[model samples]
Target: MDFNRKEMDLLAIKIRKNILRTIASKGTGHVGGSLSIADTLAVLYGCVMNVDPADPGKKDRDLLVISKGHSGPAMYAALAARGYFDEGILDTLNKNNTILPSHTDRLKTPGVDMTTGSLGQGASLAAGAAFADQLNGSSNYTYLILGDGELEEGQVWEAALFTAHRRLTNLITFVDANGKQLDGPTDQVCSLGSIEKKFEAFGFHVISVENGNDTRQIYDAVMEARAEKELPSVIVLHTVKGAGVRKYAEMENCHSTTVNREELEAFYQELDAQADDGGKGTGKEA
Candidate 1:
């Protein structure tokens, strides 16, 4: 399918808006990470991935496993925008009996392929899925998204080793290197010292996007990853925590915070400004 850069960029803005709306319904959420990955999700769900919203369980359809399950709000927004479910259900986020939980759950969410929350576990699960697909001679790809802090998990490296050893080219992984995690800056907590080099050392093709919050860059990187025929690929996204919202991006702790309707409106204002400027609406001022 041909990718429309403009359409994906607009979709990213819409996804960010809905993400804030979803989290605001719950009063608090992992807004930082959720906001950061909006562009990538937009590029993937907008046109890249081969998915059927009407048939969520379609056989051999491309699957996305968000290892940083806390960012489920963004995924939910993307899914809703892609027509997996009614956008009205986004207001039910984290509520009692709501399908949109705080984390991604395969059984609960229509488009979520794997239930992920326990940090590094998603790496193994996605790798296993790719391995199975490879064995079955399936061309469908399995995409994985992991938080930068989650990379500290030993199991992530273990899964990386396995993926590289097995030459799981069908597996494409992304690290949301937003530089901030739960407590504070990821580097301050535990420096990952060059995520690209680490992935290269692990025998995986690594692509680093300087402005990962740009849908165009994310889409280009994904295209590059898809063209690699030998080794597994990982794209390290250099993003700002709480991207696309100046107020939240400036906050000392946007990882998880309270967001009222007023604050949500302020975020929308910033996005609106970006939209008016004919940009991707990530609120990264030039």
Candidate 2:
């Protein structure tokens, strides 16, 4: 289903709402990181990715890996919104025997392409998947999303080097430069200086999208990346930790939180307002 700009915006808002609701239902989850990547996830599933909800295991289909798998709620919300499974399953997140764990699991989830929870491994897995597809002479692309904090992992840089060395044009990476992590601001924690330049130094074609929360911009960047034939592309997206809902976005400790019924209702209402206002849900409120 091809979504126009407005449709994509609404879908992203709905996905953000779903993420909030799911976390709220569970009483606790990664709200900040998950909410921050809602727009990017929305664009991928709603516009950029060539995925079939009914045939998720199609060999030639595009793959997406969430490297910072703590943000699994965002991916689950996106998959559910895309009709990969019944949306009702969202309420069972983090529950016993539930498929929706804190991280993605390909073995348990219909739309998940890889099992990812260990921060840096998912990037390597994504690069490997892209290389395998290349070996099989398939044109499908592999998309991987990583948290800015995840860059602290040496394995992520190793995978980046491997991807660039192989010239895996079928692979695209996005860094959710949300500035904050489980502890505090990434710069304050570990100081990953010049993310785009780091990827460029690793021989990747890098693009920095200031408004990563804009679905149109995200779609355009993905299209541009897909057109590149010589290098793996990296999009350094500047984002906020808790993006959509005003309360969480402003909170310093929004990374993970216990939500009450009132908080959940407010979050949904804010999402609805943002959708109605045609706001992209990334900008700071006045």
Candidate 3:
């Protein structure tokens, strides 16, 4: 399951393209958050996670609970790409009868480990799951990804305390510190000053990766977190809202949008160009 930079880059490109296609089919969805987590999800699903598409509910399988559940499009894309379901299902996202809603639902989705969308509850659930695994003497690890905005909820801190107090070393949390929330920038909305320091104060080990789009750094950070036996780990990842697509990445209103046919065509064209750009399409812009 080891992934080189090239393979990781390709996975990111595929995930980004899948997201764009899904949004196009849905006509409206959460593009910004989904794109922001593409690289991190790529490294996890494409390489690190010990998940089996055939036995998604296996007792010893690694778990990935997307705390920022609005980013379900990305998770769905990654899971489908990883063979948990038919990739064609992505086009049905957000439809009335589609299992792929804007938020994840474990009951309906094959690869989803938790049904999360109520803000801060997902992190708490992830912690509980991790603690359960530890108590049962299972070697499985649980990974949680939280939005910076979601951290404003009081329950996130409560979960942090619980995870640290229990010393759930099998759990790893990643804060998508993309700065922007739904309405505005996180700093302006409610300053979560020094996120890493706050985690350290909660009796957990914390690491800050300046570039969230760097697959290698994310991989190393997660590996380091896994090696820690005494405490839970949090990695504060700096990211852009709409990451890979250039125009969307710069646009303020890219969080959720109506995807017209023309825009969808253009976006897919851009993604194809990115995939064909040799080493330049690796999600890093100069």
Q: Deviation in angstroms for 238 in model 1?
A: 0.4
Q: Give me the overall lDDT of model 1.
A: 0.90
lDDT of 1 at 85: 98
Q: Once model 3 is optimally superposed onto the true structure by TM-score, how far is the C-alpha of residue 94 displaced, in angstroms?
A: 1.2
Q: How far is candidate 3 from the true structure (C-alpha RMSD, Å)?
A: 1.9
Provide the lDDT at 81 for model 1: 92
What are the TM-scores, per candidate, against the unseen true structure?
A: 0.96, 0.96, 0.95
Q: What is the lDDT, from 0 to 100, of the residue 172 in candidate 2?
A: 92
Q: After TM-score superposition, what is the CA distance of residue 15 in candidate 3 from its true location, in Å?
A: 0.6
45-94 per-residue lDDT for model 3 (tens digits): 88888888899988778999998899999999898888889999999998
Candidate 1 stretches with Cα past 4 Å from truth are 276-286
**Candidate 1, 1-286: lDDT as tens digits:** 6788778767888998999999999899989999889988998998889899999999969999999999999999999999999999999999999999999999999999999999999999999999999999999999999999999999999999999999999999999998888989988999999999999999999999998887778888999999999899999999888888877777888999877977877877777667555444444422
Clashing residue pairs in candidate 3 are none
- On the 0 to 100 scale, the lDDT of residue 240 in model 1 is 81
Model 2, C-alpha of 190: deviation from truth (Å): 0.8
lDDT for each residue of candidate 2 in 90-169, tens digit (9 for 90 to 100): 99999999999999999988999899999999999999999998999998889999999999999999999899999999
